[model samples]
Target: MTSPHRPASHGIPRPRVWAPLHYPGFATLFIGYSVSSLGNGMSAVAVAWLAIELAHGHGAGLLIGEAVAAYTLPGVLVALGASRVLKCLDPRLIILVDAIFRAVSLALIAGLALTDTLSPILYVSLLGCSSLFGLLGIAGDLAATTELLPSELHVAANSLNSVTSFSASIGGPAVAGVLIAALGPGLVFAIDAATYVLLAGAVLASRRYQPPTPIVKSSSAGIRDGLRALWRFPALGAITLLCVIFYGLYGPVEVAVPLYVSSVLHASASVLGGYWTVFALGATLDALGATSIQRFGLWRMTIAAVAAWGVCLIPLGFTTSAVIGFIAMSVGGLVYGPFIPLKKTIIQRSAPGELLTQVAAASGVFTVSASPVGAALGGPLVAALGARATLAFSGLATVTTALVAVAVLLAYRRRTRKLSGDR
Candidate 1:
């Protein structure tokens, strides 16, 4: 396939921001991806609530913590093994199979919940099992997108992907909360299950998206190949490291925000939802403006995003007013949203397409690997220091990491230029 920046046709004008949708297959893929993301978002809320409910207020915190941990942490192990699966299987088949697996798992969980047989261990196990496929699905989905569209549209398309995720996240929790209030968490799981069916259908319909021929595998292709491939691309490797640290440090925000709301602001759950919604809104807005930011260098934009995230979190840490917190979170989200899409686009452009799935899977491992670590640290830090103080430290640490990144990136670029000159 031609590079993303290449002209669509000799005499044709450059494609606009929404150009990817014009490709019928990509449109189908986007629809499916969005639907699936919405379900994932709803599940994010439902699973934690179910865990707490199953706890019967006994060790509810630990139950919910385990459930959350189960939902994501298992994906790390799955990602480590996913490169082998992606290497041996059709990426399209991998995505479709994952959707099927998740749909069945959710349906079973919904049934179990309704039957009042869902134990906390059982619930966490089911979610964790389903998430095994989740990591593989993400790797396949990104590789599929990179294959379906020309490389030039990667940024716009990824921006659209981000918008779908952020929009779903904003809307999903609100809808799930209401549904849970009226019908309980079981029904929400059922609905989320239905959405996965929709995702599966979309994947099936995208059969027309034929990827370019994959690289011929040598006998040595194995689990370690993904990480090795990632390191081979210096720019992508650096960017991926930056993403890991940022998410690692930002992990505390997940724990700290809710604590801050409950402890400091003495706010209602609605206030917590409002904070998340505003942040999602900011991310949605940033996704919309991604086309405008395309003129800037990716590394520059990435650094700025990291810096802005740290700066924005300061107000969130210090603020006593919900209004100020909302504004701060919104701005933080705005700055943070672009970094992810930017990171993905950079990886897509820089990495070999044939290794894209493995590289992405490896990237996922690095990116989320820190969340559990941060959570482990965050619990203690919050206990020792107030949630507000914990947030400030997280923010400051992220900014410092970003500053270190600036130096590292600058040096890397200079060395690369010198090497090219020598050549």
Candidate 2:
């Protein structure tokens, strides 16, 4: 097998944005993942709208919160188990299994909705079931990217993945609004389910072009090994903690934004979809442009992005105009676009190759849980403070978190410099 890190000498100069697609294996996976991401993006809108329809009476906010949380929280447990049960499996197999299981679970939900037998309990339960492998799938995809490209291209590969999802966001919600209006959210979900099947096929096809290395069996230390790796790399631990805080703060927006559009703006689903579509449009544009600014350093880029995102979101809290909300979301998306790729790049560079999957999974356990936990809290916050106030509060708190991170990062740099002088 050729060295995964060996750069291909294809004398042809490709645009930086399209560089990653030059590799066959990564290209194949990227194409499949991009198609599936459109479905996921549609489901993002459909799932919340469906929950709102099912929720009734005073407890609606809490129920909506539970329904949204259900989609991702279950993955926390599955991710924990991955360290033990999934460590020996090939990354491509992990991706395939997740795609298959999610497809089936979502198909069941769609079927129940179409049959008029979908209760809130069943809907939430099935949503939870659909995401059981969510974290593992993410870890697998990252691991597979590492195997498919050299280290130098990993950042670009990660950016491409983010760009694909954001691009789907641009089209998916707009299309979903039309679909939901015409055929209802159930059909939209069915479409998403079909996309997963395509993703499974993509993973299978990639194996034919470039087979992944077999994972050697290791001592069954489980999540402990992953935790040890995090401990050994303080930077990873710090980055993971920042992600947990940042995502947790952002979670309330998931609950608040929908309510704000529905109740505050008194807008239809299309308007709500419009907000997301605009946000995604900005994100996609910024992500494509990110390669140009990477020389600034990932840590600096990440901090600045978070601070700017919080600032952008503050405008939404004060404005009731859908136009204003759209503007805020669009700016927010630009600031938020670089975050995932930058975070993933840091993890990829920081982690040991042997423990990449475990470290990703372990870090994922916290980062993944953060948003859901915040969403669960969002219900009560929205109920008590109103959606507008909740949006403002989340923004303020996120800004504070960024400031704390900045201070911590500066102090750490100073300490490191002092230690080097002593040495």
Candidate 3:
């Protein structure tokens, strides 16, 4: 058994399902990411709980919404501008710095809560400040994955990364609930902070396989270059546009899910909870053993996954029975799990190594930016269409978009092959 630390052959042999774990650096990176995911799980519960605690009687809902917005919106803002700064530094440094800022800021929030001096202004500011580091992720973590792992193992590596977050999604909230019950929500923040500290340590200890390939360009030029590369590559452009459509259309479903369960299905809140749990469970199970899908080819698998995801939602819209709906949602979750890792693997494999980080950043901004637009549209759509109609539209739109992208991708491949033959 060869150590994952040593470089290995780039053979596309039968998918050694556990091949990625052999790479010590990837293994270390995996652990750090998994821990961070757990912390994120805790943070989600803590932030919402704390917001409720700090809210007076009036405008409590508004305050909670604002705090959540503060945590998320800043990353979009930072991602827009940080590409140039990220191009100038090692991505690992950016990740480490982000982790450190989050740790320190979370600790401060805990301290303030303990002292009975926490205010909405201070709370929002700390969370916003802490979130700014996440914008660096466009260039850091996924880019680091490309740098550390061989091309053959990219899918497996991303699968592991995706699963870590899913695992955390399940465990983080449970533990956070226990701590909040025993101690308080503030303690959850402190625990989350400690997880970041551990993540930073793991990142600090791991090695980079490639040197930082710094791009020498003005800020405007760097940003332009990143944009131009995406536009220049038809496949990349199509995939990104597909991402925008799929993500935007899917956003409405988030709003529709709870509404459908409560109003349409006439189920308890726990049933809605079961809906998500089963979905996550399906995703986790699929990710753990998805290496076989690689045999079908990355592009085909990606297209199929997106279409399958949309297809899964159709059953949800048509079904009235909670059991049947749960089955549909679970299938969606199973198919949805592989889509992201496959997408990331495709991007990293196809992108130029030098511009990989910047390209990823730009794509990240585009895709993430679409979700809010989708969410904003979601409320109105649900009002107009109703939950079942909205869910059906969201699913159908996703499928239509995937089919269109597949057609475009196929045409592009034919042209490229023809041009190569002509040359």
Candidate 4:
């Protein structure tokens, strides 16, 4: 990566922002992004809790269930369109505008909370808008990952992003839960609103960047083309299957966790938040050593993440102790970064430059797009099947991911051998 300027060191720095031989913008942007992301974590819990209250004495977990659906449903349905939007706009502009968009959406949520007469319909709309903002957020992330790092350094860059994300995740839920319980959800929203100001400031301050990939010029058909491109790879068949299982299994646990704590453990809302923080901490730990994991190999990392995540789910599902469950949750979180980064790296490394963006968006279509359906299923499954069954379902999903990924890797290996022989 070419540095436009030398990095300015500040505050117990993690990496240089700029250097002729190194890229610090990746870390800098990710750090800023992590801060905003932490605020988002807080907002999400607060929003879920607030929505539960609006459900008028229903279990707060139920509201979390619906909120998950409302937020992720759009990601599935609109990703193709979002891909097209990215095609037409500059990545930097998109990043800047998205910051504003998120800020507005967050402010709206806080405003509603403060009115003391907040309506259910209004809350739903604002929450829905936040999800749409997230759609853009993911697009911006793909752009940053592509523009900021040289291909060879993807693992290190991804590790940084994972750490930043996990750190924020660890802090957001615990803080949000406490703030909501003590001062009410409105204050959580207020804090979130301020973070947006900080987020926008960070983006605005960034050095200018634009990708070198040629434009596909098929903005209108970007989604159609993106979806169509999936057929070009047989591995995607298994990938899709794995994604369904993973999301289906895990989404319920997240949706149901708050209720499980409140009812089963007699924990306060603040305590519930702390429980989530533990889970995030586990994920952060994974990112901390991601550099070492990547040194082993991306394919190996994917397999490990899938298989370990599955086994971890078993203990997590059965554990009555929050501390024990959190320990398991942390393990699961560690597994999160390697697979995500590997997925992106694998796809980018394989595809031609101009097509990288579309391929990345295709991933969005696959991973997040399925989240709502998972959320929708989570509600009824939790209501009827119970948490253990739900947790078991997620474990099953992980097993499927591991099995399918191994199969695909073997097949790809065979294909490469055949091509080599022909040559």
TM-scores of the models, in the given order?
0.92, 0.86, 0.92, 0.81
What tens digits encode model 2's per-residue C-alpha lDDT throughout 368-423? Answer: 88987888789899999999999999899889988988898889878877987999
Which of the two, 1 or 2, has more lDDT?
A: 2
- Cα displacement (angstroms), candidate 2, residue 338, comes to 0.8
Ranking by TM-score: 1, 3, 2, 4
The residue-by-residue lDDT of candidate 1 on 233-347, one tens digit each, is 6766787788888888887888899999999999998899888888889998897566567566666787889988998887767778888898889898898888877777777
The lDDT of model 3 is 0.77
Report the CA-based lDDT of candidate 1 relative to the real structure.
0.80
lDDT score of residue 17 within candidate 2:
68
| Most accurate candidate by lDDT | 2
Give the clashing residue pairs of candidate 1, or none. Answer: 4-151, 4-152, 5-152
Native-to-model Cα distance after best TM-score fit, residue 339 in candidate 2, in Å:
0.9
Looking at model 1, residue 36 earns an lDDT score of: 82
lDDT of 3 by residue, 1-423 (tens): 111232222344545757887877767767887888899988877888888888866677777877777777687678677755666766677778888988999999998987878998899899998888675654588888877777777778878888888877778887988998888888888888888898888777775533444544444544456677678755556567778888898889888999999999999988997888888888877875556676666667778888998998987778799988988988888998887777776677656677676777777778876877797799999999899999988899889878987887678768877987999
Candidate 4 C-alpha lDDT tens digits along 150-204:
6655555666666666776667777887888788897887787677677666665
lDDT of each: 0.80, 0.82, 0.77, 0.64
The TM-score, computed over Cα atoms with residue i paired to residue i, of candidate 3 is 0.92
Query: How close is each model in CA RMSD to the real structure?
Result: 3.3, 4.7, 4.3, 6.2
